[model samples]
Target: MLRVLIIAQCALLSGVLVAEVSAADPGSRPNVLLIVVDDLNDWVGCLPAHFRANGYETAGAGKIFHHYQNHPSSWDDFWPSKNLQFPPTHVPAKEYQPAFDRKPRPRNWYMDFNWGPLDKVVEETGDWMSMKFVSQKLQEKRDPSADSGQAKPFFLACGIYRPHVPWFVPRKFFDMFPPDRIQLPPSKADDQPVAAGPTQLREVDAR
Candidate 1:
């Protein structure tokens, strides 16, 4: 029987293998569903609620030397990151809205507060077309009638690119973290300033 386990944790870890079929067998490998979110460092809450609820949050980069390695035996076959390709250039809409619908910032931002359903962000942004591709792959399921009436188990890995931009997250997410309720980083009196060039003074000062 095919069983599935999805590791929703931030780290790209391949957990213990439950079963190992013969490599020579036509059905040896488990059906793989891959997901790679580009520039996704912080926001991972876009995943299914159950997976997020039981997930283990870590720095995720604890070990630098062996971080992204996967067990060779985890799958008989595998595909590396697919969304590594750069996104298409974006053209702003004629009429623009800002986050919280508050006011559009002078600098263009992908996500600010024009909101709708959760998946609406994926639906609307052409730059984020990769999300729709991943969604379609997720929808494809094994047909029980085909394949000798036996359904093969699958190993699906879904990566949510929430923290990554163009931010385009739902409006509810913005409401969830209003400016007042947000936490600011503590300023340290002993913080040291690095040397910067005259040309980069404005950019460095902003930091």
Candidate 2:
């Protein structure tokens, strides 16, 4: 019998769920599945590596770490490999539009900040590809024949890189919230200076 432990870590939410197998004899080591979002950037030490060293197969897919920072030894296998850490961007059709004016911005601004509904399907995105890879790993019931050939515990990590920047989700999601029914909080003039402070600084730095 095999036991499973699911650890879900999203933006600000962290949870652990222990699932017991139906068989009477529980396995020695329980498989661990860690699902991370942008929070993966905060991981200084790789938990998967620790588990790997302790006789568990470790595998990962997607943005487990920041593009610049990666612990290769952490996983026995990983998607996109080391050479191609950041996957190709998914460009939508010409008809699909951006939320912003698409005007030139200052170099000081590192990440592109914008929001809009994409005309493209979710499957076209790199995240979806990584998700499919991880999904395949999760469906594996036993180790490969090259290995011990028995049911082996594994430490699997999946990183979802959505709800972060560029906010270009599929139109289906946006349609769920009708524009007419949406509401915005009351705004004060006093808050404008503080809110626009960052933008002003970027403009000044560019010049």
Candidate 3:
């Protein structure tokens, strides 16, 4: 089942990264290679049901799941989930931030339809580099079961950090798609229907 989440920013940033690498043994247990990328919307390719599914069991993403029991390792040991814990609890950014509160810069709306990297780019190394390293090694990296003599399945997770803030991308990649070749997204010149009546009509008389 496909699911979409629309934040306060209208359209969902719906990019996901999921790839599977299994061994030859028909009965071999799967070893998960989890490379979890963050902040990317749904434009990434071959993204399985990740935002919803938990772990290497099968991907599907909607929210964070840290239930270790669900994804046991080949050793039958429970894995621990880690988070970037700076504070004990969540606090308003304006209140807690020391130097750059919310952020030093404003969020990119991508309204200009601009191509290529920003003047001051965000992702310097680029996700492609990271993905290439992980994608190539999944098969070779799988652990062998001591008794079984077969390669175990594994989850290879990689994190793609940008396309979020600065919307930085390398110029060579942008050149692949020329403006003339690109097709515009469908649109309606007129206003579309809305389920919620305008606040004006619902609350006050409009002269």
Candidate 4:
């Protein structure tokens, strides 16, 4: 089943990200797949609690919720576990080395601020691992061993952590669009200002 969420300037209340899912098939309990993304100009909500409360089995991986406000009760299981919140970075935290050529800048979260080709394979990254886990779950069949003798409809939320920051993508993707062939979008000084408020309050390196 396919559903689209249209969200605009909506606040997250009671630690739940709420949004309307349109075009759902009537009278059928279809499995839900909630794919949340980070650093995108759009926003969304948490529907796992509601689905679970209504007899759905909830599971999630990656950035389903903000790293700090994860709701463990909302999910039957979550990736990176509830304690870890986020998956391990492509580069281990302890072994990370910052750019020495540029002057040190003060910031709240400074790691992974630089971008370039990663020396590692895509399979070695946390995002790839999370995706693999989700794929495995999707392919799983209902277990007859359950007490109910049947499996409940699943509400799976997969959070993709890319196109956000630290664009250490594999060289192949970057190679597809050569820098010389890239064209800049037209802009004007008189254009209306972009969305700004609490969302844009933080410092992010979107290079």
Candidate 5:
């Protein structure tokens, strides 16, 4: 009876079933590493510009490093030397305008230095490095019999936030791309068309 039901379902959803079946499996549920960087353009070593600039210094270096180093290392080690040199904490420059808090009260609350919100979430929630942490915490709750063993092939995600506004990265990252060397995008001629709406110009002239 169950076989007949499954066959009918498969006939109805043949496309979906075919896709699921044909999907590549790297064997034993291959580990996934999802690294989400906030507002990060494709400026990493993997990109073509990096190769043009650095001449593939670290190309295929990961395979070599992984073979040598033990499993699970600091996230910083994976990055280039320049990236690792970020300031322990970032401080905005004098000309910088505060986006969140405009007017000053007592202390510069917004300007005050601290790791961004996502970092706090990782530290508070679980071990930032371990892939097994997710399986144990997130998956094991629903199914007590579910394998939480480290050998059960896993996934890990490490998110690094920087090079965003306030431009508060390490002095080294800033120094790496000097203003003279930096390539600016071509300016479009009158790209922003003004929308026809209420005119404040008359009121301003009257004042």
Candidate 6:
């Protein structure tokens, strides 16, 4: 009877192990939430994109980091350049001028104006407007079951444009990093490397 009890216990343990393995398999797809933030560098508290892109399963505390990072085929697609329509007069002398110069100055039109308590006269109005617009869209897509009656599982992407100059963000975010407290990135004054080709030379010069 003692031998029979041992055999029964072993069988129960085997079943539990099998169940755990099945739950942990990668092929067993869970509800995927793909949040791709455009032009977002490795700055956020949850560096999800960096981990997933590099095949890192988890961070220090066993928290899963499953965000994928994607690169644009063309440089133009890197940012919503076309969306910010430039005036005819703003066009550069050269047909294919550098992207930095090609970008329209004074005002960026790519940002939405609606869905915000933003001041039109504020210098960082565009940034505030864009954040509000993106946030609203995120709530709509992610929390669809709340009021929209859409209960389907979704892969929602929340893209935010930031730390990209005109370095525009709301006053609250700006206030977080005071100029005196801000530590600038280290740069080498005389660290110029030779370019491999004309194309490489042009790219280096542009930078």
Candidate 6: worst-modelled 10 consecutive residues by lDDT: 58-67
Tell me the lDDT of model 2 at 112: 43
* TM-scores for the candidates: 0.28, 0.57, 0.27, 0.57, 0.22, 0.23
Rank order by lDDT, top first? 4, 2, 1, 6, 3, 5
The residue-by-residue lDDT of candidate 4 on 1-207, one tens digit each, is 012221221123123232343213322423222222221113333467667778998887886654344566677888878555577766433233333223334442344354555557788777888898788778774434443766788988787877666566776777788879999788664563432221233323322
Question: In model 1, what is the error at residue 127, expressed in angstroms?
Answer: 12
Instruction: Name the regions of candidate 2 deviating beyond 4 angstroms.
Output: 1-45, 86-112, 142-152, 192-207
- Alpha carbon lDDT at 144, candidate 1: 37
Q: Write the per-residue lDDT of candidate 5 for residues 119-201, one digit (tens) a residue.
A: 13333321222323334434544565664543232222232323322233334444456669888777555663231111111
**Candidate 6 lDDT, 37-103, residue by residue in tens:** 2222333312433443444322111001121223221112211232331111111213223432434
After aligning candidate 4 to the native by TM-score, how far in Å is the CA of 154 from where it should be?
1.3
* Candidate 4 whole-model C-alpha lDDT, 0 to 1: 0.54
Runs off by more than 4 Å, candidate 6:
1-127, 138-150, 166-207
**Candidates 1 and 5, the one with greater lDDT:** 1
Q: Runs in model 3 with CA error above 4 Å?
A: 1-125, 142-153, 157-167, 177-207
Which is better, 1 or 4, measured by lDDT?
4
The list of candidate 4 runs beyond 4 A from truth reads: 1-46, 92-104, 142-148, 175-207
lDDT of 5 at 27: 35
TM-score for predicted model 1 compared with the true structure: 0.28
Per-candidate alpha-carbon RMSD to the true structure: 16.0, 12.7, 16.1, 11.0, 20.6, 19.4
Instruction: Give lDDT for model 3.
Output: 0.29
Q: Over 4 Å off in model 5, which ranges? A: 1-95, 98-157, 163-166, 183-185, 192-207
lDDT per residue for candidate 1 within 1-207, as digits (tens), equals: 112222222233322122221222214432221221211212332222223334422111111111233222223222233212223323233233322234333333323322232434444443345455445444554433455644444444433333433344545666677769888787554563331121122221121
RMSD of 4: 11.0
Better of 2 and 4 by lDDT: 4
lDDT string, candidate 3, 1-207, tens digits: 011111111121123222122212223422221212222222341232232233332211111221111222211111122332011111223322222223332223221121233232223344444444455454345434333644334434444434433223555556667769999877574654341122112211111
The clash count of every prediction, one per candidate, is 3, 0, 31, 3, 0, 0
